[model samples]
Target: MTPANARLARLRGGIPAVEVGARGIESVARNAGCTRLRAIVISGLTPTEIIKHVFNAEPDIMSPFAMTLSQAYERRLLENGGASLLTAYREKGHLATSEVKISSVADHAPGGGVLARQRRELETQRLLDMKHAGNPLAPNLILNPRLPLALVGVTHAIELDYMVASDDARSYRVGVIKSYADRGGKTDKADIRAACREAAVGTLALRQHLESRGDDPDLAGDRIDMVLRAPGSFVPRLFASMRAESEMASLVRTLSTAPADLDEVEQLVPAGTSFADPRVINQIPNNYRSNCKEHCALWERCRAQALAAGQPIILGDAAAEQLAAAGSITRALDLLDGRGRPPDNRAEAALATELRAAALLLDRIANG
Candidate 1:
């Protein structure tokens, strides 16, 4: 590896696999099904000394803004007895805004470190226990409550923006605050989907935690609230409740089948291999797709590798599917130019015919 490549590899490998707090769970959920997850797992398992580098972390651009909006919304809910947010809730007549009491865990054990995290966990559990015991003082809305989760043998904690009590106080709902704007009942579908997935994971973690405590898991309902910015302003608005039962089930299935440790992945590399070495990274298999650019740090390397190998996937998924029979871009061009024979398969022959026709049309247009 060249000096520049080695430095880049070290920079990428230096990022902690699991960030502290809720961002950790969000990162894991976002990177699922991508090569980034594999890199994250490897980073976590590898010794830090092997991947040492002095680097300043970039400031998070979105989460802080979202958190600020959420905090402001929370304040609004507290003011005037949550009159502004009452209409956002689907339930009606069974409860009143004035009747709801809001509490926050944001200030409890603030800051990073093992001791602070332990304190936050203990405080969250204590509050949940109170709510379960039907304590009248238990607030209807719990903000920034940290819930524990275990994924692939690694323990993580997810801090939900809000855990609101049901009208009857028999259950709670998960809430996620996002900065994406919702205009005229419309928002980015991808953003909505991502938020829903995050909320589902948070709900699942809360449900599992309740179950572990011998409480009714149903206490954590499937309903999730997405707090999004209003159409024309930064003001937060609660969108309609989304049911995440299917999403939760899908994640549950994924978790059950995933490897429990790095043993399986570690076998792919030679003993004592350091991911800080660009050569070692190249040896690992990667499934490169256009979307991988959004989530994977290794996207550039993977795309270059795919291009070098003449893999059709570098052209995008739809194009790759269409050219699947050709197997490679070079072979596809060869077939189109009549320099290579099509395979005996009917699909390949049909594809070749279509490619040849397209090439002829392009040539005629160019000549004209």
Candidate 2:
């Protein structure tokens, strides 16, 4: 086997197996284009308390502001007519008091534990079945609905914040409540993209479940209703309706193909290996980038390795690309110092000339 594949195999064996959930889906979607990140996640080496204390501390994604805003938004939705407002916004019409029925699965599952999660899942399925069966008593608005998604060898229960039916009651749209605020008609583009990606995963899971039950998958629409705070107030409003067909297709492909990749990597795992062994972890290759600090638990280790190896990537992507031909930062420094052999290629010769000119300018300035 190739050296890289062998290292990946060792990494796969070292980490414990973990089940992917709604948050996992968001992580995958956020880094959809990063193959190394995807491989790391598939290997099941996530951030843990031990790792956090050992390695550099990762910035918390959930801040106090975010937490407070989310709690307030949910509370307003429950206490006020937020549900009806969202339904009307989604359906693009007025919702009558008689037509809007709100139900909550969160109340049945009070405490946070495995048992609570299971209860919520069961209740969500029961309500969904009733709604699909056209039961008059079925709720039109469901809070904290958990939907199941069967993957290659595992199943994921994705819990959504809200699920509201369309005006005709023939279809349902996923509602994602985010803490990001909307200023006028604009919101943070990156935040919106991330929220939409998460919504896509939920929509796909719901659609697949409906198809499995012999119901119309189209009942789960592709559009996601994003609920965000108003321009200056904490009042929730429907900010954007994003179509997630492309994002959903991308996630489906990832879920379908990830297992095959893992299986191939698993073939090279040694017997009785575990990530708790620091030797095994050190043997694994590191893919370091500037953004690694934002999401990776092993960013410090990876960054140190990159610096020790004199890899130009420690300087960031653009600098790395420009200095690719130099092979290493040490070699680039040697070239700059005019201590290396004559440039063998046009690109290297041009780089040498530029470095000499810049060095000369710096010398003149320093002398003055």
Candidate 3:
């Protein structure tokens, strides 16, 4: 994948993996349904951590999200639709706006590199000044405003989807334009969640930019507005009430903390460690979930690992929670058969009792 795509993954999935994984580790002990030790081991590793380890192990090896042709087409369509929506906003004169469509191809090409970014930065500043001047028709809406930030020690020119000025021209909040339809202010949970995560990162980046410019980062609002089209139509709708403070706090924490001892891990891994062989890539462990297949290419491999381990989690979240006390498939079966090891605590004991009663009910039903 491109650097842009990799950064997107880090924001949407990698950062979240680290945040939730930390929580999973902390609460694993108290939760009887958790595979305490196993969860702890896995939770300690983030997607970025695994990625860094493998990348350092072999510079030539890159683990990018693999997408099918159809998936790619769908993404392009959505992006084009978002672009069209932005153009529509300008055409309809919703607000005075300055839009700079930074072409990835032109930006990365020779001679276009620094100049292209410099131009965007200048334009972004100009728009900000206009907004601050309280010019009613000032470029209150800025599309693709570049905000720079460091991710995993690499400096990146991050861009917000849209930076909108408040009517008072005293503050701004980031807007994420998503193709997901807002049907009476309702949409797919997963779609909204992903969009929110993306917007949170943009918000954080914008705040960072504000701080660098000697402005109060608080001027960057804790809320993110998701601009979407109505279902089955090109008409745009703005979901402006989505608050992201809680999620943004988690993201900000994990992103700001840097890990130690990566150098040691890199030294230990053998040279020429590349993704050339499927077997080699398989050797690197990853936390697999049912949702992994949505954005991860190695979904099938990870799914196989879960299957081989007989992790009930492979079925669903509910199954994982229900079987948590059982810990493993073998243990669950043993409990049902009244041949499992003695429960270490009251919770497991109670779960065992329930399992035995269910087993008896199943036996009776089978006999009848």
Candidate 4:
């Protein structure tokens, strides 16, 4: 076969990822099916989605140097340092404005190839059976310089959320972030307030998702109230920010009752910004995508620790973790510790359904 044909074969097959990135969402989708792909994307790295998006336009994304869709996203990500989407703008003194780069967008179509030539497959990949799907926007992402961070934003589409959450036939979207300071081996006041902010931010997000669908049929009697839990995400960042027990205690009042004004919540975000930016969700930094319960390289360690000691072992060497306070960090670790064990059988079975559907999608592609 010619080199181009050979390259196509390799791209569609399963392969290990290269670069700072640890894995690929496309391969996952290709192997498991679109539903599984979406769930993995939602539960895996944030850049994996972007990488998948980018490659959808340019299938031959690999370089002789070994730049997989995974690696490129990481390189672009770390270049921005620790800046979340909103901070990238504020740090540059452009709080109210920013641009979403286009070259950063995915070039490949939905089924591992260019879209214009093969449109039928894309429809199938998107229309798989779904319960409650969510569409996450990277803010004009497909439009120059891609946004630096994965800011949290809310979208109202049923397909994407199910895809992200393994299409469990459930409709709810949730996100969390926590920050703290590390003063030697202790947590301080700064750390406490930060942890408080993390909890508040997550709670507010849950509130938004719940309130947005208040009168909708999905919720009225059924629970448009789908579970919006992310204690693990919020608690860690808070522990990173608060270094002392007292500091953490001081923020208790605010945590108990989130203020009407967002300034209180702004205190939680490292960039000191609010959700005023229409693209707040899209602007959230995607750096932590892979670090969640599902895909972190440290999962095994945490699993052993949680099973043995009943807690999370979140002592990452990343600069982001070190910068946070001990209190916030510890709380997050505790929350993660709680999640180490697998979900209850019911949830697991739902997740299994998603994986099978994804595999089916891949089967369709392989046959074509």
Candidate 5:
């Protein structure tokens, strides 16, 4: 097996490149699963923390969904019609839109019977002319070591609810993963807590349901415990972290036969886009989604209304800056350092406490 440091280096430096035109919001949303839809914020830690301990990263791709989607879609398109249409489309637009249109002279206007038949024949034969590859997105996105945050939890078990595009002859799925590995971190107690307070004001908010420190964790790191007395009418916040780490993956794979751009590859994810007719959600008897009670970030509004006829707070996507803020490595350091703020977790706080206690030991080791 590759050594852990090598793996960390590879993840940092080995990302693929994509043409500029291929970049879009879809992939970003899919990678991070953040859209203008119902949004929530979350925090925790996992594999990423360990990697940071092993290898330093700057300007990391915290979440990359578009690339994951492109990987899923391209394989399907190329196989069905060969690469001519795809190639042509790419040549024309370079991969920005979610839709495409194809046309032939024979289909557009009347041609001689022979000419029309030849045109149809041309399409059939042309597809056969080019050899095609099999699916690439199915296994890799799921198996990648750097799974997405949406697929993880405090328990570290990965939940696979990723996307899929299946039809006759082949299938590709982007399995949703959940693990504590990508959990958000909070060291900026004032900043993050302030934001949380803003988010919680309308609802009966949180008072540190749990705490952690870096000294030791009941689970992974040190832990923090809290007692939350809420109206029981609150929304459990969950940020749209990446469902797939297309941006973070080193080097491209079979998604394309050649070198690829991680930036462009990420544009094809579908998560940030809207779902079908969200407005009609209340009309549906059981609601279009059975798990909406738990899944919806606006669950508080839903619960409040159902319980005590509370007024509605419309659903919206998680705040982008806030989500981005939670994942900063600096914040991790703060949690570990405890310089100016409260440690978000007991594990982090304890580590800081120890680091201060062992400052001379740490300095001696650094010099050595």
Candidate 6:
């Protein structure tokens, strides 16, 4: 077989491995802060009605706006940020010997060949040498650098925006270029949180690389420098080394635990769970919420179900959790209007009493 065909074959062989490895971090994050939810997502059953088929839960939905908007936003951010970074680095007095050099990983895609291996090794060594030499511009604003890592029964080639030297000079931090404008030195909270999550993925990959090379992995923090636009302007602003140690640790643990969950969930999947029929897919149990509409493909159907059932999840997570004691809107309303009795449990009864009082207050105000 020709070299190209040989490369394609090798890539095909590693497809499952890549899925198990590369998607581990993302799957882990998707189910974060809730283990049951993790089980659903990691099983590849999330935002699907499969769970509903089994448990009579809501249909799965993905909000088109959330997914499309974010993808477009990130693409724009990275393109602009790359140019901005080169300029920013040069402005810091580091002269680019030539028009900013970027190591394009795609030229050698579907790796494992000797040339590909050498290219990666050379880039890795260059970064290391710069770090050892305390070169502030060691990573050189790499356009798309791939870091190879193996963890928790999976292996992934993690791509990063750029690997930059940290403030300490001896250590390095992942450089995550975001498009969010830093207004008054503050960006959107949700955007910052999402950026940090992506940064953690890069950091984990880097730390794994460092450990494999016999370097001190601890020196690498789950931190990233967010390069974004200045508040109300198009100029780049450098936000140095924002650390999210807790987020990083949580990510690692979640990914580490995901493989086992995936195994179990796959086992639970029925033999005839094909998507040939829309009704079959709708039978699958799904959890729906206001957030689901932003990212899930099945958001509309799931949302209709939530509205029909009057599930508090139609509001959002906080409201759903807050009203969980009532179980449904109708039950809560019944309690407030003195038409339905609260459960015999003390905590639930207390909640009912509070709702009743609030309802009475609202009634009095409305009448007045």
Q: TM-scores across all candidates?
A: 0.76, 0.73, 0.64, 0.19, 0.19, 0.67
Judged by whole-model lDDT over C-alpha atoms, candidate 1 comes out at 0.64
**lDDT on C-alpha atoms for all candidate structures:** 0.64, 0.67, 0.53, 0.28, 0.26, 0.58
Better of 4 and 6 by TM-score: 6
Output the lDDT of residue 75, model 1: 65
- lDDT for each residue of candidate 4 in 154-190, tens digit (9 for 90 to 100): 1111111110111222332211221222343464543
Pairs that collide, model 1? none
After superposition, the stretches of candidate 6 with alpha carbons farther than 4 Å from their true spots are 1-83, 90-140, 148-152, 166-168, 231-234, 256-260, 272-289, 293-298, 337-342
* C-alpha lDDT of residue 354 in model 6: 86
Query: Alpha-carbon error at 273 in model 2, in Å?
Result: 1.7
For residues 98-167, write the lDDT of model 6, one tens digit per residue. 5354444434343866577557646765666566556656544555566765543334456666666523
Tens digit per residue, CA lDDT, model 1, 1-368: 55533432444454443333443344345545544344444334222222232112232133576668656756665345444455455354334656566665766687878688778778878887878878777766776778787665555576776777743576567777776677754666756767887788788878877898899888787778777767667455676457877667656664554343444444554665545555666766666777655434445666898999999988888889999988899988877776856565887788889998888899899998
Off by over 4 Å in 1: 1-17, 20-32, 39-95, 216-219, 256-260, 340-344, 364-368
Q: Write the per-residue lDDT of candidate 5 for residues 1-368, one digit (tens) a residue.
A: 33532322333233221111111111222223222111111112111221243223322332466445434443333343323323332454432344232222233223545455445434422321121123232221111111111111111111112212221112122222111121235333332322222222101100111111121111111111111111221211223221222221210122221112322222322333211223322221211112223223333334333333211111222322222333433554455455567766665565556546676688889998
Give residue 223's lDDT in candidate 6 (0 to 100).
Answer: 69
- Clashes in candidate 1: how many? 0
Highest-scoring model, lDDT = 2
Which tens-of-lDDT digit does each residue in 37-139 have in candidate 3?
Answer: 2221232333234344533332222235322432332334236434554455456554335542222222322243567766775666666655655655554
Error of 1 at 62 (Å): 6.4
Alpha carbon lDDT at 304, candidate 2: 88
Error of 4 at 192 (Å): 3.7
Ranking by lDDT: 2, 1, 6, 3, 4, 5
Which candidate would rank higher by lDDT, 2 or 4?
2
Model 3, residue 343: C-alpha shift (Å):
2.9
